[model samples]
Target chain A: MELTGAEIVCESLLKEGADVVFGLPGGAVLPLYGALSVYPAIRHILVRHEQAAAMAADGYSRATGKVGVCIATSGPGATNMVTGIAAAQMDSVAVVAITGQVPRPAIGSDAFQETDVTGVTLPITKHNMLVMDVKDVAQAIHDAFHIARTGRPGPVLVDIPRDVLLGDKTEFVWPSEPKLPGYKIPTVAPEAQVAAAADLINQAERPIIMSGHGVLISHAYGLMTDLAEKAQIPVITTLLGISAIPSSHELNLGMSGMHGMAYANLAIDEADLIIGLGMRFDDRVTGRISAFAPNAKFIHVDIDASEVDKNIKATVGMVGDLKAVLGQLLPKVEANVHIDWLQHINELKAQHPSHLVRESDELLPQYVLQRLTEVTQGRGIVVTGVGMHQMWAAQHCRFTEPNTFITSGGLGTMGFEVPAALGAQVGRPDVTVWSIAGDGGFQMTMCDIATAVEAHADVKFAILNNNSLGLVHQLQELFFDKEYIASQYTANPDFVKIAEAYGIRGIRVTRKDQVLDAVQQAMETAGPVIVDFMVKEDEGLYPFIPSGQSVKEMLEEPTLKEIT
Target chain B: MVQSNHTEQHTLIALVEDKPGVLTRVASMFRRRGFNIASLAVGNSEQPGLSRMTFVVNGDDHTVSQVAKQLDKLIDVIEVSDITNKSTVTRELALIKVKTNQMTRGEIIQIVNLFRANIIDVGSESMVIEITGEEDKINALHNLLSSFGVIEMLRTGLVAMVRGQTNGLANGHSEQVNSSSNS
Candidate 1:
């Protein structure tokens, strides 16, 4: 019954069903690392950087639907996890981050490796606790997991002082239930609001369901698809909502946003009823709030009431679990196909087919992604870093399952794919996990190649190596009159050589013909492999809406020619 | 001044378990959401191990409700109600220090007596007067005392209650009140 705080932490984690923890050891966390040896069931992954630790835990959480645990020493270690924590918060991934603080007496003295991690992570975390006493350790851990995985899940931090971990001794008893009083999680929405939403769906001649990450969180993909098909509504997914329903589904209208498919954005504009489920109408999705879906009446469904009508006004707001709302709604909604609307959507898709330029010997990012998709048969989980490549993957890859197409959609954090893919691979060893990154972003956390080698993660990296920040370069070329500054990297590192140095197999392909073979080879490899596909530098996201412009002002390649 | 359509004062009453750092959680929520508190007061509630916090928040009607909703989501919070539009009794306590001379001391006492305020502390050259009233009344007294060259002033913000026998904490206004209370 008696245990140190460190032992209490391990026992609590075991009680919470955490089989693995991703973290790095530092000065303040020595006691934790010492105690970790005694508990063999909870495996600890030693990441190269604190950021990777957080990112890996985020990936694990997204892949497994459990609260991923990551730990770090205080000060710089805790600060390094800031980006990953924010990314998890933005994407609503459930992660419990633990940081070691200085001893209780030395907290205010600014002792070695001291930081106010609880204070620092307040805005980014759903909730956080600083355990000043050993008695509070188990309860705090229990509450951290409970808070992180509940309704509208997010990251939570528990800061344990070094002395608490090493000094204080107490009788440890795991509470049968977490003593969280104020945490009321909504399982079902109000019936009247659900009926009102159902009414709106039934009444609309052209309705569009804009699905977001909530579908995956609630595991309501079946219900969402049923609602979409039964109502004969087109489904436009947010960037994070990519795999809510399979991309190949008849009603699934691809991604909708700044870099979204032309037809999907057009459908959103033309729809009379917009049912926004579990996704915040972010600025990127709605170019100009005043002009966004001007003709549509919104029916917002989310677990968090605050998100409803925070951006665009919701005519009918259903605040609760997405699955419960859809369950209540499916019975009332009548099956009817909007034939005219479907015909119009087809016409728009025909007009703006995703540009697939396959000139001799030239490798386009889209071609690489499509080839990668073909090599994997779209069966693998693709974790993407941000940039033109991310959009390319979103547009080109076929995602058949929910939570398989994971990315940092809300925070748009680059360097995410590498560590995240490692975590994903660790969590789901049976599945093929691919980390797709641009050359610029791949370099940011390529240090985690060592982590992949150490963990023996069977993750494949599809580096769309354009040797520059392609998205920013395209922006500058389009808007800055070709005055490229920091966007272009004068000397990019040879990624294959770096990967090889890190003891992972590496291959480079400059020509389009080599993409398929390289991707296939990387997929066939026993361990982590990086395929550097040298893509064209000038390639830009087509049907792009300029900043501050309405969806109506979208510019394709021809429109760019006209403007120039 | 042309007022923004979104700007309005919202009075919120929250019942939270009296535990360490509950105040910090509530305060941090407001700070993180960037909602400036006009005034705030916290004290032990009628229920044991429970604290009631009254906050005057300045935000649009939508955002104020959002703050309340977010507060309810915190682990320690038990219940939150926007008592802004409710018929309620609100009171604020303040201690005002005014620089009073021989010429103005008698006049200050007369004005204090008129407002039913007490002179809590009298200094050699100044007087610290105490008053408890609605915010408007306290402001009025402060305005009158300012003419006598006010030195320092401290206000306890505002605390409120509904007019009738409706117990804000006991009713099904929140989850698990009776369950936790029984234990």
Candidate 2:
């Protein structure tokens, strides 16, 4: 039973049922790499960058609902994992990041390749540990997996010192249980609050359901859709909650908030009863807190109790797991609700649907997103980088199931899609993975294209190239009186050339007519492929109701008249 | 203003690396959890480099348990125990600054004398009284002195140790010794 500390780490991972680990080898982590060679059951993916390792693990965790594991060496190797860890934390992905550290004696002395990896990532992770002892290695790994997957799932870092990894240990014994005093998972729903919510829903004349990423995370999409259908309520999803319900459904009102459909925003404004599910009312969604649904009676249901009253007061607050709360409320709720409200919502939906100018020659971001959705038939996982392309994917992509469309919701981290797609592809090899990134965001971690090629993952990168930080540029044009600032990046590299350099297939589309062909070609490529769609810069995401403003005050449609 | 409402309470114990900034992270966590610590104590354990943090908090049992679980999840925290059931001892230290003029100086001194509190420092208009006991005992003394204008207060959060000699280091210490000898 005797094993080296490094061997204990690999053994503990196997015990936790990890079949694969995504990472790269370095000096500090040589011990782990040496130990990993003996275990043939667990596959170690060599990523091009440490950041991609973290993203791939995030994707794997989201797809499998298990703790995604990634490893890296000390210093820059550990620092590179920060973005991915922060993304996972923001999106509540279950990921365990293992990094190598300098020896214990040299920790504060700033030894070779020594960095305070734990302190650097403290704010970004749910929890982290620096293992200095050989005996604590197994327990630390076990505890890392346990903490990452339990309660509100998030990333946990386990930094093993180089000396400890090389140190000898008598036996590796994983902790039988994690004894955490302050980390209780709330399992019971308050009966009074549930009854009150049900009563309000039944009595309300104008009820609207607002869904968020929590609904998808809890896998309560079915219950949510059923509730909307049974109660005849119009459902409005946040950008992150796009795939929680099918867009084809009669009750689906597209997205809500700044760039939401005219009807969804207006409906929220007029609603007397608002059932907010698993969504923290971000500034994008609530224009102004004071004017946000002022007349509505709010019933907020979330697993995190802190989110309930943090922003936007709630008339009834139910704190527990989303699916469990909905499971209880569904039975007590009545079926076949009043038809008048549904008809009113349908009328609004028909009156003002999401429409864009369809010119035959002009390349548009909307056309690219729609074509990708068509080519994939909404069957594969779609990850997105933050910016104009993220909003486009959220608005245009037709998602049929939950957890299929993954993006950085809370943090809105740019350059998230490419590596995240690699992770998702590794997790679900049978399914196709599409990473939608803008020109600026795609450059952030496009080196991960090499990782995709190495892994031979079936991933397609749809780079919406506008040659600018599209979101920021749009904001500048609208709010800052056309002061472009640092939003524009001149002398942009040809993404196709860069993709070819990574040993991956590449294509470029300059016209709207070529979008479908480019997407189809990328989809059929055996390995990773990048399709750079040359979109026009300076196109604003429309129907934006400025933050802190009422939904009624939204720019309903793009106007020919210029703002004074 | 003290509310006349009954609140639930629980005991929490956390094993953390004896280092700087560890206490700050633990304190921030307590503040974030919205649980008021009744008593807190921190001291070096038999394990040369680790410290044991013990605190009693008031909240629903589930919330208290959650707080313990969360504290255990901290990177500096090696282990966590809710020694509410297990045999353990909990204590806290408090220093209260009291405002006393000619009218209430004697009364203030009388209350401090009764509680066996020591006067650590004295100002022109106020005297700082130091006391160490269970949180309830300090609360009782605080309640008694509130009638005579209280100026400031400093309370160390509760830290607890398990009964007898079953320390964290002791359990693993012998095993380490045996392995080293065998090698």
Candidate 3:
């Protein structure tokens, strides 16, 4: 039977088991939005801005390990979504962005609401196509989902013209699978590389595993644990790889790199053999490329071959899916012990522990995050914005589940928490979703509170309101000689009131004693709620390593300022 | 991502979907990665719905491998092969138009004839010579005609195929490096 391009889109979405789409409707996408009513299986959640749609989809994809979908019109809508799309591309999240273009006749005519969106997004997207014919709509959507959800997953764009969506010239033909000859998904690592990795793991005296976002993406947490446990090698997670292995795991050694766990960075620095799994050695994780893991021989395993030698050259670069590579390597890996290396790392951890929160009435951000971690007990899916609060959340809020701690890692995009939490809630309704963002980041996407209320997204938001943008403030203090400038904004709106205005319960906490009560209230009160913690201003993220410096230059305490 | 090493010229052939804007995708990749393309030749391939692209890349083996991997990652690209060190016969076609008066025209033709080139087009004051050979051979002919004041020159980037008893495009270098779902 013949169906409009819009119906084929809906049918294709259902075919891919896409239950929800985060999108904003515009002039070109009006027909597709209208067709959504006919397909009740796919729910459409309207976003306030086009950018939020992409971020929400990215958050949804990362949290649930499913291909997330977002839609927009041409021009500004597509351009606004670029940042979020680029974020997904950087972090390798699986997202399909369906953008509407001007009618075919009007294309390239400098038409109204028209943009060369495919061209604009070519560099940022894994793949993109402009569907000129109605008959190809299903193929485009199916192929887009396939490309986005496959190996080394990333965002893909499918631009459809307004006329194509409204057209009814061709019969609907839904191909069971994409016939993409070029798109490749690597599954297993070659035997030689796996054996090389095994030999390295077995022979090395000071071996460590650097778990990356790919670990969580491939669901290789079990295999990651097995590899580390069998060799008794310590595991250091990258920022995006926070939840790959539970923080409570004996072999798990917190996070690494700039603003990461001090011990983790030092351990990476001192290790002789580094097994990099499913993670790129991002610059943030490697302070200075020349000095990063100076003595370590790397065995890098990732789905993308380009990523293997992109940063630090690998001794044994095994290109394949992390799960399959780990599986192949794990069997060949013999049970061994690195007792002295673990003891040395233990000493390093002892020498460089997290700053202890003082027992006082002042409500510290650390105390708040500590209490929040206790409240969740690994049940909450925590999404965070970028800043000092993000660092605090990473250092304090421990995870026992994979995909539970979601944040904007590679792109480090601010304003990710508020909407991302809602998207995470939408994807996993049975679990409690929490947004742990700094006040600055919270304010950037505070408008999404309305979206949460409208969609009935059961999310708990904790605004670590420190007034000033703590990260920049600390940086300025260190480098720019403490000129606060625009970074410090003491005269800020009461965030609790803002949340209340959006029709959600809001609580303000100023005293240390009120931290527990505020957190408990936010988590226990159904629906959606917010708690604004008046965290200490000028709170520097500790164990800080200045940019372009190696792990040896990590400052265990705040420099340039005397402790109170 | 970029490394400076013993730089050498590498030729790559990519089999891609015969679709619109695909060339733009390939060109954009080279431009974005800051890889200088010495020459690029594209045309229809033997397979239906597929096109062939031949380009010369100047970089180390790492850079060539990176270029191949990145190109293979494109959705429209079926496969990419680096035939730099392969046993293959390669050729390029160059059309050189030299500003020739009656005095120098005869000498240019004789020089072209010696290089197995043909004088394809003759103008009132200029002559166009077509040469098909290795890049160096064409350059040699072009150099000899340069003193006669060459007006313009166009070179079709190198195109290559494996020698007898070999399939250059069906080699293991591309397959060994790429591990994908369908593999």
User: Each candidate: how many clashes?
Assistant: 0, 28, 4
Query: Which portions of model 1 show Cα errors greater than 4 Å?
Result: A355-361, A559-564, B1-6, B169-175, B178-183
Look at candidate 3 and tell me the lDDT of residue A53.
92
User: Which candidate, 1 or 2, has the higher DockQ?
Assistant: 1
Please, what are the lDDT tens digits per residue for candidate 2 over residues B1-183?
112244576677666767666887787777765757776778887667667777778865556656765575565666676777667766788999999788788888888999999988877789999999877899999999898777899999775666886653223333332232210
Candidate rank order under DockQ? 3, 1, 2
- Local accuracy of candidate 1 as per-residue lDDT tens digits, A411-472: 99999999999999999999989999998888899999898888888999888887789999
lDDT string for model 2 (A444-554, tens) is: 888778888888888998888888998898788878999889998899998888888988889999888888888888877798998988887766777778766777677
The per-prediction i-RMS, to one decimal, reads 5.8, 11.5, 4.3
Model 1 DockQ, alpha carbons vs. true complex:
0.42
Candidate 3, superposed: residue stretches over 4 Å from native: A355-361, A559-564, B2-4, B171-183
The stretch of ten residues in a row with the least summed lDDT in candidate 2 chain B is B174-183
Poorest 10 consecutive residues by lDDT, candidate 2 chain A: A555-564
Assess each prediction's global lDDT (C-alpha) against the native. Answer: 0.87, 0.81, 0.87
> In model 2, which regions exceed 4 Å deviation?
A355-361, A559-564, B1-22, B28-183
Query: Model 2: which docking level applies?
Result: incorrect
| Cα RMSD to the true fold for all candidates | 2.8, 7.8, 2.8
